[model samples]
Structure formats: C-alpha cells, structure tokens
Target: MHVPDGFINAPVSAAAGLAAAGAVAVSLRGARRELDDRTAPLAGLVAAFIFAVQMLNFPVAAGTSGHLLGGALAAILVGPHTGVLCISVVLLMQGVLFADGGLTALGVNITVMGAVTVLVAYGLFRGLVKVLPRSRRSVTVASFVASLVSVPAAAAAFTAIYAIGGTTDVPLSKVLTAMVGVHVLIGIGEAVITTATVGAVIAVRPDLVYGARGLAAPLKLRVGGELVDATPAPAPVEPVAARSTKKVWITGLATALVLAGFVSFYASASPDGLEKVAADQGIDKKAEEHAAADSPLADYGVSGLTDARLSGGLAGTIGVGGTVLVGTGVFWAVRRRRAGAPAPAERETV
Candidate 1:
C-alpha cells in the first residue's frame, strides 16, 4: 500500500526513512552480487512491468481493490536483492513523478513493500523449493504461496509501524484486525499474479529465473541395495531457450504498455486496504498534506490536462518509461560494480 503523508508522525516517519535508507544501501550491495549480464537488463523490464501492473488495481472485496506488489514476482524471476532494487526503483519513480506515495512515506513504502516483502518471500520461496519437487510447477507454487503470505506480512508491518507512530488515537487491535483482514483478500490477487508471471518465465527460461536455477533434481539409480547418484550428461541450451529471453522481454514490455496505457482505465476506484483501515480507525484524521502536492503530475494525473484519460495516460506512460530507464541504469551500474572495475581517475589521464 502507498502510505500517504500524515498517517505517521514526524519521529516515526524519520525512523521509517532511516530504515528505508538502510534497506536500499543493503539492496545496492546485495544486487551487485545478484545482477549480471543476462539478468541485469531484464531486471529493469521487470520493474517497468511492476509499474504497469500496479496501475491496474483489481477488485478484491465488494468495494476494496488491490494491485500487484511485485516483491515475490521479482524475487522469483530475478534475485531477492535485485528484486528489492527493482521495486525500490519503481516506488521511487512513482513517488517523485506520479505522486502515488507520500514523499515522507517513501522510506516507509520501500521498507515495507520492497525490503520486508522481498526478504520474507524469497526465504519462503527458497525453503519451499527445497522441499517440493524440483520442477517448474513447484517454482510457481512456491512463488504463489510466498506472495500470498507477503501481503498480510506487509499489512502486519504497517500495523506495527502505526502502533509506534500513528498520529490518531486508535486501538492497536482494531487497526491490526482491519489491516490484516482486508489485506488478506488483497493477498489472493497478489498470489495469482505472482504465480502466473513466474510460471510464464520459468516455462520459457528456467535458467534465467534465479529461483528456478538448479531446480532439476539430480537423478538417482538403484544399485545393489542402496540408491546411488547418477551423473547425467549436462543438458545443452536449446535453440528455443536462446530466443526465449528476448521474446520474454519484448512480451513483458508490450504487456506493460497495454496495462498502463489502456487496461488501467478499468481498475477499481474503491479505496484499497490501507485507505479503508485508516478511515475506519480514524487514523487519517490528522494526516498531513503531501509536501509535493503541487507537482505537475501529482496523483498520477497531469495538472493542466483537462481530460482524465489523457492526463492519467500520460502520467502512466511517463512512469513506465522512467521506471525502465532508472531501473536499467541502476541495475547496469550494480552489475559493473560487482565486476570490480576501478574508477576512470585511477587509470590516469591519457
């Protein structure tokens, strides 16, 4: 959920900001280890896709709606550290350009939506993968479950944050119940999207999916009375596999454009889980105005554009474009950093 300004007080907001900063610092380093030539470029596309799908909020309960969170999907497709970075990039773009989330709540959003979800989902996905059969189906299953749990987990985290710094005087139990209940419904939507996306990727390029790598269980042959490992010949990369990567990227970008530019018009207009909880608990009574409320593209709509479609369309396009550019640049830099090249100054003037 994109927490707007005023939900939390100054001290709690500052604390969340610091926590987000720390998480990004850690993600930068961790991503250096995860991203590479093959996946680094793809990570940006993933971020863009996340940005697109997030615009398409699906109806959850009767009046509530939810959108893809992207933490589990990213971690399953890419690596956890890089997943965090991907989501962080999208959140950053959405915050500054679209004014989707509060400037002060930037840290809060990233920490809860990016860092915490990635860590928990990735851990759960890996653990399940280890126990389940080593197949693409298993990977998809694990991703689904991980995503399902991560939503409620994020809701719980927000409750904890609210308990610490909620400006309004609401009972913690009420807040927790409302947050968890609505988010649980939202979690179903998240799980479906995550599973489908991960399944599609795994089907095309299991090797490219970080979580699916090394998923083929080693074969065993019965010898005498005991089971012995059978060292099968290494499988060669197939011709379809070579083109799969490019196809997936093109398809992903195309899908992103479709969702953000057109399909987003159909998204539910009802308040999401967070907004509902805030209103019900009276936690938003003292909610402050956003610092960047006057931005040209605030609220995911252009200021001067009279037509709602045109304004939101342009903003959505800009968001997708910015997410791809910034995310790609960050991931490419992380890849370079991991490669351990020295600064140009260290090479001496030529």
Candidate 2:
C-alpha cells in the first residue's frame, strides 16, 4: 500500500527513511551473493513487473481494491534481500515520477511494505520449503501461504507506526481493525498472484529461481535391510552456463511493457486498501500535497494526452521502460562487481 504524505509525522518519516536507506544498502551487498548473470538482469525485470502490476488494482470489497505488493512474489523468485530492493525501487519510482506515493513518506512505505512484508514472507517460505515435500507444488503452496500472511503483517506494522507518529488523533483500535480487515482480503489476492507467478516461473526455470536452488527430494533407499534417505548431490557449479540470463531479462522486460502499456488502462479506479482504511479511520485528515504533483508524468497519465485511456497507457509504458532501464543498469553493475577476479591462479596462468 502506498502511504501518501502527512499520514505520518515528519520525524517518523525521516526515521523510517533512514531505516529504509540502511536496508537498501545492506540489500545491495546481499544481492551480490544472490545475483549472477542470469538473476541480476532478471531482478531488474522483476522490479518493473511489480511496478506494472501494482497499477492494476483488483477489487477486494464493494468499494475497496488492492494490488500486487510483490514482496512474497519477489522473495520467492529471487531472494528476500533482493525482494526488498525491488519493492523499494518501485515505491521510489511511484513517489518521484508518478506522484502516487508521497516522497516524504517513502521511508514509511519501504519499512511497512518492503522490509516487513519481505521479511515475513521469506521467513515463512523458507520454513515451509524445509518441512514440506520438495516438489514444485510444495513450493507454490508455501509461496501462497507466505504471501497470505505477509499482507496482514504489513498492516500490523503500519498500525504500530501510525500509533507512534500519526498526524491525526484516530483510535488505534479502529485503525488496526480496518487496516487488518481489508488487507486480509487483499492478502488472498496477493497469495493467488504470488503462487501462480512463482509456480509458473519454477515450471519453466527452476535453476534460475533463487528460493528453489539445490532443492531436491530425498528419496528412500534400502541399504542392509534398513531404509535410508538418499539426498541428491548438489549440482556442479558451471560458470558459462550462467550466461543465459540475458534472455530472461529480455522476456521479463517485455512482459512488464505489455502489462503496463496496455493492461494498466483497464485497472480499477476504486480506492485501494490503504486509502479505504485511512478514510475510514480518519488517518487521512491531514493528507499533504505531493511535491511532484506538478510533474508532466504525474498521476500515471501523460500531460498532453486528453484521452484517459491513452494518457494512462502512455504513462504506464514510460514508467515500465524507465524502471527496466534503471533497474537493469543497477543490477548489471551489481553482477559485474560480483563476477570479479575469476580464480587468481587462472588469471595468472593466462
């Protein structure tokens, strides 16, 4: 959920911003271990895709709607560290370019939506993956459950944050009730999207999915009349085989473009979970004007295009393209840095 300005006080927003900045810094390092030629570029596509899907808000209640948060989906596809960075990038893009989320409240959104959701979802996904059968179905099931829980957990996090730095004098209990209630419904939508997307990706390329790496079922083997678990050996590391990431990157970018450029125009215009909760709980009484509201591309519609559908479609396309290019550049640099200094002996011998 995109938190607009004035919901939280300035000090809390700054504090949250600092925390988000720190998490992003740490994720950059962690992504190095998680990223490679294949996954790095794919990571950028993931960000753009998340950005695109978020535009399409599916109806949750009669008047309320929700969209893909992408925390669980990202973590299941990539890794938790990278997932946080993905959502953070999307939130930042929306805040600065589209006047969607508040620039001042960027930290709040990152903390509640990015950090909290990813942490909870990834932790749950890992735990389930360890206990459940090592099958694609199990992975999908785990992803669904993880995604279901993450949304309410994020809502709880926002409740606590609002209790501390809320601009209005709304009742904490009411805020919690409304926030959790609507978001729980939103979580189901998130679960379906996360499970379906992760399952589809795993079906196509399990090797590229970070969460499914080295995952294998332990077959039972009889030895000396006693049953034993025979775990499969880890696959050998092959450097050259990792170079196929370019295709995945291109595919993800293309998918994002198609969704944002065309599908986003059909997105529901109803208020999202956060907006509904805020309006219900009086938390939005002090909503501040966005600093970037005057931008040409503000509000996910082109400035000159009078046709609502055409204007929104053009804005979505540009956003997807910009995010892909920027995110791809960042992730490519990360992969290059990680690909440094192939064996020193090999270098010296060469």
Candidate 3:
C-alpha cells in the first residue's frame, strides 16, 4: 500500500526512513552476487513489469481492490535483494512522478511494501522449495503460497508501524483486524499474478528464473543392489547467440508496455485495500496532500490532456520506460561492482 503523508508522525517516519535506507544499502551489496551480464538487464525488466501489473487493480471486495505487490514474483524471477530494489524503484517512480504515494511517506511504503514483502515472500519461498519436490510445478506452487502470505505480512507490518506512529486515535485492534482482513483478500490476487508470471517464465526459460534454477532432477544409477546418485554429465556449451537474452528481454519489455499502456484502462476504479481501510478507520484524518501533486503526471494522467484514456496511457508508458532505464542502470552498476570487476560479458566488450 502507498502510505500518504501525515499518516505517521515525523519521528517514526524518520526512523522508518533510516531503516529503509539501511535495507537499500544492504541490498545493493547483496545484488552484486545476484546480478550479471544476462540477469542485470532482466532485473530491470522485472521492475518495469511489476510497475505495469500494479496498475491493473482487481476488485477484492465490494468497494475494495488489490494489485500485484510484486515482491514474490520478482524474488522468484530474480533474487530477494534485487526484488527489494525492484519494488523500491517502482514505489519511488510512483511517488515522485505520479503523485500516487506521498514523498514524505516514501520510507514507510518502501519498508512495508518493499522490504517486508520481499523478505517474507522470499524466505518462505526458499523454505517451501526445499521441502517440496524439485520441479517446475513445485516452484510455481511455492510462489503462489509465498505471494499469498507476503501481502498479509506487509499488512501486519503496516499495522505495527501505525500502532507506533499513527496520527489518529483509531483503535489498534480495529485497525489491525480491518487491515489484515482486507489484505487477505488482496493476497489472493497477488498469488494469482505471481503464480502465473512465475509459471510462464519457468515454462519458457527456466534458466532466467532464479528460483527455478537447479530444479532438474538429478540422475540416478543402480550400483550393486542400491540406487546411487549418478555423476551429472557436463552441460553442453551453446553458441553465444543461443545464450543471448535479447529475445526474452524484448518480449518482457513489450508485455510490460502493452499492459501499462492499454490493459490498465480496464482495471477496477475502486480504492485499494490500504486506501479503503484508511478511509473507514479515520487513518487519513491528518493525511497531507502529496508534495508532487502539481506534477504534470499527477494521478497517473498527463497535464493538458483531455482524453482520460490517452492521458493515462501516455503516463503509464512513460512510467514503464523510465523505470526500465533507471532500474537497468542501477542493476548494471551493481553488476559491475561484483568482485570489483565487470561481469564477463562486459569484459568481452572491453
């Protein structure tokens, strides 16, 4: 959920900002291990995809709607460290460019929606993958469960933060109950989107899916009377052309553009889980206007554009393009920092 300004007191908000900053710093280091020539660019596309899908909010309750948080989906596709960065980038873009989330509340949104969701989902996903059968379907199943749980986990995190710094006098129990209840419904939507996206990627290019890697069943051989693990044959090295990520990257970018630029028009117009809960529980009593409300792209529409569809579509496209550019640059930098050397592919060009 995108926390607006004034919902949390300055002291707590500042603390959350520090915590979020620390987390981002740690993720930048950890992402060095996760990113490389192939996956660095892919990570950017994942962030843009998350941004695009988040626009298609689906109805959760009569008046409440939900959208993809993208924590589990991104973690399953890339890695947890990179997943946090992805969501953070999306939240930042939405806040500064679209006036969707308040700039003052950026840390709160990143902590709850980026850090909490990614940690809970990725941790749970890894655990489930270990216990379940090592198969593509198992990866998808784990993704579904992990994503479903992450949404409520994030909701609880917000409730805890509000309990400490909430600006209003709403009962903690009521707020917690309402937030968790509605977010549980939202979690289902998150699960479906995560599962579908993970499954689709695993089907096409399992190698690109970080969580699906090493899922191929090990070979077995019968020695004497007992079955024994067989030594795996060396994998054949394909031509450089065969290993190129250009096709997948192009396909993913196209999909993101289509979703944000067109499909978002049909999304539900109702308020999302957090917005509904805030309005019902008086949590927005002290909410301040977004500092970027005057931006041309405020409210996901372009300034001086009369057609609702055209304005929103253009804004969405711009968001996707900007996210991809920023995300790719950030990830590529992280990749270059690995072991204080550029990735192998980069060295090839050098």
Residues 180-231, candidate 3, lDDT per residue (tens digit)? Answer: 9999999999999999999888888889999988888888899999899999
Question: lDDT for every model?
Answer: 0.87, 0.89, 0.93
How good is model 1 by TM-score? Answer: 0.93
lDDT string for model 2 (1-350, tens) is: 89999999999999999999998999888988888766777888898999998998999999999999999998888898888988988888899999999999999999988999999999999999999988888888999999999999999999999999999997899889899999999999999988888887887778877888867676889999999998777968877756466666677777788788888888888999999988887889999999999999999999988998889889999999888778878888877887884776887888
RMSD of 3: 3.3
Candidate 2 regions with alpha-carbon error over 4 angstroms: 229-243, 341-350
TM-score between model 3 and native: 0.96
| Highest lDDT model number | 3
Q: Write the per-residue lDDT of candidate 1 for residues 33-73, one digit (tens) a residue.
A: 78877788899999999999999888888778888889988
State the displacement of the C-alpha of residue 22, model 3, in Å, after optimal TM-score superposition: 0.4
Of models 1 and 2, which has the larger lDDT?
2
